[model samples]
Target: MNYDECHTVKTICGPHASCHNTAGGFFCLCHTGFAQLSGKTNFTGYGAGCQDVDECLQQPCGPHGVCINAEGTFLCSHMTPPMTSHLQTTLSPFVHCLSNLLKDQSIIDNCFTKRLQQPPADQFCSLINSTLAFARRMCEQKGEYRQKSASVTLKDVTSFGNKFVADGSGVESATVFLGAMENFATLAALASPTQELKAISSAHLDLDVRVIDVTNRRFLAHERLTLRAKNDTLDIYMKTVTEEQQTGASVVVFLSYTDLRSLQRGEFVTEGQPQSHLLTSSVVSVVIGNRRHRQLRDGVNITLSHTSQTQGSLSDWRIFCVYWNHSPSSSHWSPEGCEVIQSNGTHTTCGCQHLSSFALLIATSKVTPPANRLQHHGILPNPAPIQNVLQLRYRMV
Candidate 1:
């Protein structure tokens, strides 16, 4: 080889007999049987070595596996598919994906990381609670739509001045207003005595109550209703019982009407105070404590107040009507006809007969007061009696 030519390749004195060339220098390179290993060659003085190249980036393997190039050598390896996907492919629909993943937790966690972290845990829990509370308010609002008299105010649980605040240690006050509002729904344990509710206004014939509260000792929040009755019609001003609370609290409520009639007979067949028909239905109770709260471990108790107009012509009747299982599912109270169970003052159970849903053939009679009575006793009649045969259907469930 030429001594001055940079392009010439010449063999060095080292035992490795390879030759290579560079600018103004000639060096030994790998022979046909070998290739230079990586980092083996460096330019120092006149005797440096040539480094091997990694062919892995060039994908030297059959394109099905990884290629790792080493000094004068290389290796190829096949990648194994994930076990989950492997089973999915092999077993088709019969694959037991959970069993495989449970045996290996890391694989499952890595796969689901992005989906699971979309919403933080705290935000998820808060969203759930908010949804439930919103649903309760919506149901209550719908029920209040049917009230005839007396304004109802929906109170926020946080708006009350005397609300309970939990301190991880112990409750500061023995009693706190978990929530308070007009037409608020309450629920107590089903076993509690139903007759313990406070009567806001009681009329022998008709009644009107301004404020009613029923907080039982059971720590449940139930319904408390303030009502105004006119003529033979009753206006309800209260929230609809929520689906969850309805089954837990059952009470005996009373509703009084002067006469009971049957469409088949078309005549007044009976007259008296029916206690069974009056008391069996549950009335709305006011809940003063949070049913969901724990430390006020005991349920809440409430008080109710009523306003009576003794001088009015329709103030004598204080009646509470009971409509049981009123919904589209109720087949007993049909539009064509329904049964009216009447109980006289003397009998515990009243007679039952079929009548139209809107059939009220009862006489428009009046209750005569005592001749020597000093106070003016007024009897409120049904303001909107079902006389025109406009039969309405209600479900039981």
Candidate 2:
């Protein structure tokens, strides 16, 4: 039997469909991108015709970009560089400003106003070290490790005038610098630390001066003095001279300062004035001799010694003075002047049992007191006044 003759069937077109035959089975089908309308079929009826599917209507690309329909799948293309994220974009301005400030702050107008109250300590250390380095450079320019044993003489000590005039507190608080010296030359390298200074001779002349005010209080000037020496250790004779010292013997061995008596005392400046000395500690000058820690006797006048045997840069041979106060609170006045009197029912006020009662009040008289107390200063004269205030009275029947 022939296949065509065995099963012969006539196909009729239905609604919204095209007919296809395969392996003796016939089915209704629609073209690609079109859906078949189900059930009955007529030209314009429900299943009679295929509907044209709109690819753009679906909008599969989300809201950010455009979606293109291809043969089998859809292609999503960004309309613009994917728009910056709202969250990240919103913070861009803040990040930019912070980064700009971190760069050269010259453009920032309020940089100084926002500066920290105190610069880091490391900053001060760097500044001081730099200044020392400059001095070391000057030393290297002259010579290195010039040793003078018998009679050491130094010259040109005036070159380091500014360093010598620094305040005592600055010098004492400065980090100790240890310099690496050249073997033959006394001149130290700029990068090295400055520790012990070299001298020319064994019996060197040491000159020291303390600035004493009218009240007999002494202040220290810069402690490190410029001196020329042949070795790291020894005594050397030095003379302080200006550029003019070359022609004359005007090498001043000592600088004598006499305090001028000022009539101003206990006078505070007007309010709103800039603070001239905030956070700065009061500094005192202390003289140290051959001993490392021993202080020279008070009231001793330091002067220059005249001697014949001297050679080399005698100008830099000035005594190295050290600045220090007894303690951090050394500026506090000792409780000696003030007095306090206690009050009782009979006498109303009397001296307390302590010897310092009177001293406390006197010492504190100058200070603007925060409260009403017998002692205005740091010292307390008597505890009886406080006791009297605490006593209680009761009515009896």
Candidate 3:
């Protein structure tokens, strides 16, 4: 049993350090607010570079609070709120300014883009949507399950923005994904299954959270719940009915986001006209768990998986299954309640019926772009065979 990759070995560790793998070899450490400079804690070879310690020298936020620091880390901010996280003093300065604007170096070399850079990655997804609008107000903090829910408040704040992700919830049980496309509130935890059985998963969401009856919310009669996810891209089937106790998690949720399209680029209108799609899959959000499975008479059967087929056109890419709306005036992505049923080039089989947040767009170009220019993708017209559909178009130059 031989292996490698202890970070591709180039002096192994030095500048600000960070290896960590342990038990079967691996260790470097020294990032969070850094140290090393030789005041050693672990070393070897080109090991040792980290320094930045001053966590505000020592004011750890006592006298009227306002630390700021920032390098390894430090940012108490304005202060006076902690009756128990006044939402970490109003979203911890947008997670410490998106973890220090991704350690800026020209946004770590133009935001490690993954492609489809809309509106020039809208100022890097508007600085990661200021942590996705406080991760959608921590998923609308509904009802009660306290202990300061959220697996016990950000479960040891495990690496954000820099992208590691871990939550370890309050009562115990963590692993909350808040790095890319992070929203839907630090994903309220639930691993407890004290028999009454069914599924509810993570790693990258796997569905079917069966077992209802929180006082006969009904469903254990002929039980029906099926969900599939673990990479192969996507596949989900739904036909659930509730009622079954031993309760813990049943606010009914089944999320799967690989970048809730961060902030969806090229958002083809749908049901309101204006088309020109290209999302091609990487968004699956089905929040069903009663109120009659969240308004489903018979729908919720998604099956997307088309990140490409040589990039566009299976009869002009047409697909659009959309959802995720708003109102205080208006938000967007509204295909009215979805229904693609079948598509080709790779996959597409939706049937939604009102849940929330979903995506599939694809129809890349038969031109269509007006509607105040879909909030600027540089007013369209680059048309040379869908230029790989908005070639990761994030423009701020």
Candidate 4:
């Protein structure tokens, strides 16, 4: 058939298409990069209805890739590296360290194996690994593993020389310092008698901890920490401790111990001297003998009371308290209003007059000069006592 004759015959096709005469009739063809909207590629209709093909809908790109649709074709390109999300930035440093460590197969296997010994192995392993990683990071960050470099300058030597009237004055000062250290060491050795008593006592103790925002004078969080004299090591369960109220606030923690008598020998609380540290920009941990203090923000106090069930009796327990402030200029610890309120062989109650970061030290007998006394007797007190109408008493259950 001639083209004109085929055209005269009412050939059917859709828009955006062309009609061409074939042997007997005409057929419709769509434009490039497009398809027949009605699902017909070649048609004997007057017009061939065509639409753009959505190549992106077919997902022609690989993982981490993007597809760009154009005319009748699509282009696939790799996506750019993803920006660090807020969640990643907010993740604790310990989590990052543990994630890196757990990537090792041997560590994972050994950890999992150890965890299997305890029921709920997976959960315990996770907690243990995370805590270890956090502690590791803290130690490294605090330079515990790094030797500090002391840079002595000529100016320092000159200053030292000028501070003294005679050439032997510097030597004299060094001698005095060494003598004072020896005296302190002797005092500490004399105080070692408590260890003998602690060795005799087999009491288990429970710590009731409360965090208070001293600036605002409000309670933030309360938690119970349990310790057994036999374990030698204790786990501080702090997963539920919330930190909602800790932003830019001075915090104080109160640790109340059950069976103060068993602890009186200073077995559980004598690991280190009172020290304060800023764990992070928003978190702080303070160690005072047997008690630990941390800052949290949420305003919820969880009070736990329980009686001692250990074999040993608490007849000889005495309470000793000390505290530290994080102020750079003055962080030394001193005793506050801790005094014996009531006492029995099984239990003892103590009262504190003020709120600061304090720990409860258990000893068999009271030590002279008080636990708050500085190594050097000349150091002045940093915290003054705060008076309150309400008396706070820590009763051992």
Candidate 5:
């Protein structure tokens, strides 16, 4: 049949589409930037069979821009560049202030390298920036005063300082300078794990911390430190305290163990048996204030050290600070404020809070009763009573 005589059908292609008819079949073709509604290259139906092509799927705008799809076309919107110039101007003073506060060369180098080269994550950047800003403000506020006696709590400074150190790549020298300026109390408090000590033993211990100025040979600050230690192990605690005025200040800690059991029993052990326990280091000068020029703060860094006369023995030997408590009925030693530091083991470095009169108590290792005694009593002898008491006492130097 001829084309005209075959069939005269109504236009079936939708808008933006062209319809082509051959002998007996007709097909719809969508125009550029348009597609068939059914997602086909071509269609044969009526209605609005053509739809705008989603150019967004191709991401024509690139990485730093947004693509907005429109009728038969799409728009590319580029993002604004970051305001680094303004940020750099604002952060310069704070960066300088932080650098001045940090004395360690390595820490200073690391801090600047990472801060300038690598962009920190948003959260950490905000934290460090805010902290440094606060420190700068503090320095400014205190600058106007003539005496410069303005006091800031160590707790407040330490909270931010610790966060800065931790997020600033764990700079040890920076931490030390911050600790020294804040009066070493935070370091001392952190050195002794109080909660862990409470769970270990019931023995009562008193700690004291002192700051000595080595340059001028004088005592700066002396205070009692709340120290906690495992009751089972011989623990020593030390911290260095420094003030703004003091540069070469050293912290001296004196530890003294209190024998609560002996105090309760109205018995005081004064002299310790020589072979009962071991003494490794020679008894140094017991007077804390004697060697004013000798700096021992750095020397005494170990917070806890454990030594047994015989290895793997369950019984723990204790060193006590013994001084007259002046109670008429009580003969026990009080380890409150004596000035003697003593250790029973050799090559052992002890850290204590303050100087105090001290004594040693060597505990008996054997706790369980003999098998014959257990058989006769039809039960094991009560070990708790024997274990709680100190067996021998050694004189303090």
Candidate 6:
């Protein structure tokens, strides 16, 4: 009988396919965003099922955004539509902290700002800690803001770090510096090309940005990011690795700090060595996405160069790769997750399981020696004299 085959047999079509009644017959049509495996437009038999069509291959997202394929759809992170609207009152704290850091100023400007309205010495930490607090908040907010860079020089950066360390503000410049790197990282990563190398440079700091395509490890030349300052260099390797469950565009940023020597004086990180000293005055900060607060299964390797200096004597110093750690009571450097891979008089290389601001420290047991016993007793030697030959790697957690 010429009965409606499409309506009589409710299960006429396979999943994701619809049965269309025709002249005394019925045809199967794949649903939107799906295609029949056989590539036939119309069919009556269930020989094939509908398959998800990868719209991303067609670049449906746009010109500026990267398309991410899904089971039946796709997504795009467009660089347009300024994320400023998404920011709320809660972001005020970050705005305040970051605005203070982005000011372009020379050492003289910082020193003579308002002779009658001088800021507290601890303003360095106060500003830095606030920015870091915002970074911690970003893990939850994932919000993006305006693009900004600090205009201070390496000399001024050194001066601020020293000022904070001297003020005993209970926060390390490493922590502050780390916060600032991620702060800029968030800005750079939020709206970036999926597979392109981007370099932003100014007098104060330089940044490298790369967005990873998870589907392709060799997506572009961005798998490694390197930043070079006047006399220092930072290399961030394996920027593509991320947690297995983590499924977002991985962005890597490598930053050079102004100066870390000031913060090193009081924030020694060696265990049981209260008098430990940082060998090189150089310190650097980096972040891959927002994973700085946790450890990565496949850790990232970083290489850093040390300052050049000639010393008359050397001591039995141990090299350590450390990151800044903060607590309610105090802030210090910690080498818990890092190990020295290689080191020389001028550089050190370290491998760390976490992602954070990294630096190198050389520790030697400090002790008082009487002049009478200088030649007789087993007295401790001088603190390790590390010349500019230094390269380092360190992570978070």
Clashes found in each candidate (C-alpha, N, C closer than 3 A): 51, 41, 20, 20, 20, 15
Better of 1 and 2 by TM-score: 2
On residues 210-307, what C-alpha lDDT tens digit does candidate 3 reach at each position? 32323223333333343333222222222232233232223344434444333355345665776655666655555432122246554455555666
- Could you report the Cα RMSD, in angstroms, for every candidate shown? 34.3, 38.5, 20.9, 28.5, 29.6, 16.0
Tens-digit per-residue lDDT, 313-332, candidate 5: 32344443333233223334
The sequence of per-residue lDDT tens digits that candidate 4 reaches over residues 17-100 is 556777766677765545776777786654436666655566666554444333333333342332243433433222222222
Arrange candidates by lDDT, highest first: which order? Answer: 6, 3, 5, 4, 1, 2
lDDT digits (tens) for residues 92-120 of candidate 6: 33333333333212211232222214553
lDDT, candidates in the order shown: 0.24, 0.23, 0.40, 0.30, 0.34, 0.47
Runs of candidate 2 exceeding 4 Å displacement: 1-122, 134-158, 161-289, 296-323, 326-397
lDDT of 2 by residue, 166-186 (tens): 322142222121011010011
- Give the TM-score (vs. native) of candidate 2: 0.20
lDDT of 4 at 216: 29
Of the candidates numbered 2 and 5, which has the greater TM-score value?
5
For candidate 3, what is the lDDT? 0.40
Q: Whose TM-score is higher: candidate 3's or candidate 4's?
A: 3
Off by over 4 Å in 1: 1-133, 136-154, 157-311, 315-327, 330-364, 367-397
